[model samples]
Target: MKILIKNGMLVTAERTFAADIFVEDGKISRIENPGTLSVSAEKTIDATGLLIFPGGIDPHVHMHLPTPAGFSSDDFYSGSRAALAGGTTTLIDFVTPHRGEPLKEALEKRKAEAASCLTDYAFHMSPVEWRQHLPEEIKACITEEGIPSFKVYMAYKDSIGLEDDALQKVFYAVAEAGGMVTAHCELGDEIEQLRRDYVQNGQTTPEYHPLSRPAELEAGAVEKAIAMAARANCPFYIVHVSAAGSLEFIRQAQQRKQPVFAESCPHYLLLDDSRYKGSFEQTAPYVLSPPLRKKSDNRALWQALSDGTIQSMGTDHCPFMMEQKRNGLHDFRKIANGAGSVEHRLTLLYTYGVLQNKISLNRFVELISTRPAKIFGLYPQKGALLPGADADIVIWNPEKEKTISAQNHMMHCDTDIYEGFKTTGAPEYVLSSGHVVVENGTWKGKAEPGRFLRRKL
Candidate 1:
């Protein structure tokens, strides 16, 4: 299909200017100054007042993730639907293999599970445990599978976290395999001890969730992970960095010209620890990992984002139903450690980050799309507005206004932590691989499986 989008203000990570984009065969064929291209298409969209951007790319999300509380509410189909409605055309989820399973086997199973996705997707293969043969498996994942990133955990020691020794070994394995390591940083032992103490004292409510996993512990883990990555000479990405001290460490690493990237989520930037003070019904939705920090931490993160200490942002969007959360009403540890926000990532960032003058419009594009694309090796094809790039685009109406309510969201989950939050911008139209999947926050096309992208660094 050929589509002509004319008279739109094209925005990217570096430049913002008026241009026309001509998409053909699911790729951008031309980007010319307005009225300069003599192209004819089956469809001509007059985007006179819209801001055209590369479709958003969410690098950290869990669709159909299995947990003690059951699978996260949004499977790939539902989660990708939400992602499309919010202007995201690509998603990078994770493949967490079991303790003894071969990495390729788990990756295949994960690929089958994500066959229902509505947007192009990729994965960060996780090495939950390190075995001698694991190095070969990691090499095969990079050379044969074409996935060059790995996800590691520093918390959840009982399940996925690797001990320091094993963690270092895996880093070396991934480094040898020429893959990057994206980590969930939190000091597992300290957090486990804290949780036990909190539960033993009868403080088994959602309020204790953040108390158990404090910012210091997250920063401590970040420090350790940075050192390990440096030791292994591996490129590292710290996911959902929610602590101010963690930013300091990341900033220092970047200053040393290390291949260390940092990502922060919207909840950590917009919400605070005060959210945990509410009733369980209200607070349970906020019970995510590396829980929301203090307002001071939020400010520090904003500053870090503005100063280039943080390179990207993701939602960490894994959510469950309220009933799922209720399983942890008496035991905070059991609550599914995620919340739904894939559908709100773009609007929230535009309203709060850009409109509030905390970041430039170009910076917003970088945080939401370009930087992540570059980080996960999907750059020009997924996040750039260049010729030969994928025709995944978003026409944004910056003046569009809406109130974020669970009653009107696209995520399969029932709860919304940002409920009632006012948003100032919206995606007027979203195109995935040259197909219009969403228009005016409504789905416009039939459900189709998104292609599995083999990514590289």
Candidate 2:
């Protein structure tokens, strides 16, 4: 089908224009004056007063993820629902190895499970089983599995974390393949030691989550990882950096002209450790690695994001329901980690950051959409709204005020962490590959429209 979007301001990473976007066969065919071009469309949209931007791309999210806390609250079907409702057209989730499972097997299993996504998506290989055959497996993932990015964690202990040597091996392999290696930089041994001390002192509350994983541990890991990446001459991306010290490490690395970059999440940018109130749902929800930092660090994160030290924004949307989050809360170690915010990322950024003048609207588009596509190698096709690009677009109402509630959330989760948070911007119309999947808060598409995308080498 052919569709014409009339009279909308087209916004891209670098420019904006008042033009009509013509989409044919799920691809943008033209962007021109309303009447200067003559074309017939099966459908026409009168975007009388709206800003049209490339669809948001959430580069980091965890859906249908298997963890000790039962499972990640959202599977593909529900996660895509939440993503589309929030104006994100593409999501790159992780497919990491579980205990005793080959990485390839884990990836294939996830592929089978997510056979019904409604948005375009991709996977980043998370390497947990770092073995003798790990290099070949990484090569196979890039050459055959369509994943050009691999993740290694310095935290998470035996579950997913790799030792420094293992991390170096993965880095060397990915670097040789011209792929990116992202690391979760937090010292596991230090955290475990702190946890032992905390529990020994009977200080096992949810608030201790941050105290257990201090800034120095994160910075130490960051410094070590950066040095290792430099030695291997590999491109590195630090994931969800939180502390001021860690940011400084990244800044110094970039200053030294290392192929090093980092990303910070909204939780780190907008929220702080002092906000933890002991409620498992609230406390455990925010209990991610490189835990929330002090208010001073929050501002630093924003500055990093603004100055381009941080290349992109990612949700890290890993949700565990209320019950799971509360499990063993008195012990803190067994309290499930992660929260759901995939559905609110775009709107929150627009309302709080862009509208409030923390960043420019165009920068918002770049941070959330264009930059991710470019860095992770999904650009041109999935990140922009230009002619010959995929018809992945979002028509957002920048003035709409709405309270976020899981009552209407589509992620199949029982709760939303952003509940009661008021926001001014929300996605009103969404198109994925030329199909209008969401219009006016209602979903309007099939379950399997989404396809897994392989990165271009």
Candidate 3:
């Protein structure tokens, strides 16, 4: 199929210019001045007043995740639909292996589950336990399976988290194979002790969730993880960096010229601990891991983003229904720890980051799309609008305004953390692989599944 998008202002990480984009066979075939080439197409879009951007890439999300509270609300189909409507075309989800299971088996299982996705996707293989043969498995995943990144958990110690010895082994193996390691940084033992203290004192409400996992503990874990990765000589990535102190650790590493990258989510930058002061029902939705920090922390994160200390912004879009959250009404610890924002990430960033003058249009595109693609080895192919790139595009209407509500959202979740928030911009149209998936805020494409991107290191 051929698609021509004419007269739109094309945005990149460095510049924005007026041009017409021509897409053929799911790839960008040409980018020319207005009316430079008289080419015919199956469809033509007049984007005279819109901003053209390469589709957003969310590098951290968990769809169809299994937890103690059954499963997350949105599966691959619904999650991908919401992502497309919100202007995201590619997602990278974690493939967590079960206890004693091989990484290869886990990868196959996740691929099968994501077959219903409507946009391109990739996986970051998780090494939960270190065994004698696990080093070989990590090598195979990088060399044979085309997975160049691995995830390690410093929290959730009772289940998926790894001990220092195990984490060191995984880091060494990944480093040897020229792969990067991403970590969920939190001091599990300290958090678990704090939770015990809270429960023992009869403070078992949802408010205790954030109290047990404080910013100081997160900073401590970040420091420890950096030390371990440095010893192993591995490239490290810290996911969901929420605290101001954690940023210092990352900054120091970068000052030393370490290959350490960090990402902060929208919730960490926009919301704060005050959300936990509401009633249980109101507060449970914000009970995500590495819980929201102080408003001061939010300000520091914004500064870090502006100063280039933080490289990208991801949604960490894992959500559970209200009924699932009700399981922890009394204990707080059992409350599912995630919120839905895959459908609101772009709009919220635009309204808060760009409109508020916190960041520039080029910085916005870099944070949401370009940096993620480059760091995760999908650059130029998935994050650029140049010729020979995937024809995943978004036509943004910068003047449109709308209020966000779960009733009008495309995600299958039961609630929205940013409900009632208004946005001044939205996607006028979205294209995936040269197919018009969303037009004028409505879904118009078929249910054709997205391809599994085998990334390079």
Give candidate 3's TM-score. Answer: 0.99
lDDT of 2 by residue, 1-457 (tens): 7988888888888987788989998899998976665799988887767889899999889888877779888888888888888899999988877756777898888888778888889998888856777777788888888898988889877578887787888888888887889988999888889999999999888888888998999999999999989888999988888888888889898999998878878878778887567566556767666677999998988888888889889988888787887785788888777777888888888887898888888899998899999988888998898899999989877778888787877777777767778889787789998888887757776545698999954
TM-score of each: 0.99, 0.96, 0.99
Clashing pairs in 2: none
| Better candidate by TM-score, 1 or 2 | 1
Give lDDT tens digits, candidate 1, residues 1-457.
Answer: 8999999999999989999999999999999999999988999888889999999999999999999889999999999999999998999999999999999999999999999999999999999998889999999999899899999999988999899999999899899889999899999999999999999999999999999999999999999999999999999999999999998889889999989999989999999999998788989999999899999999999998898899898999999999999999899998888998899999999999999999999999999999999999998899999999999999999999999988999899788999999999899889999998877656796466789998878
The ten-residue window of minimal lDDT in model 1 covers 439-448
Comparing 2 and 3 on TM-score, the stronger one: 3
Model 3 lDDT, residue 319, Cα: 89
Local accuracy by lDDT, each model = 0.93, 0.84, 0.92
Error of 2 at 335 (Å): 1.1
Q: Model 1 — TM-score against the truth?
A: 0.99
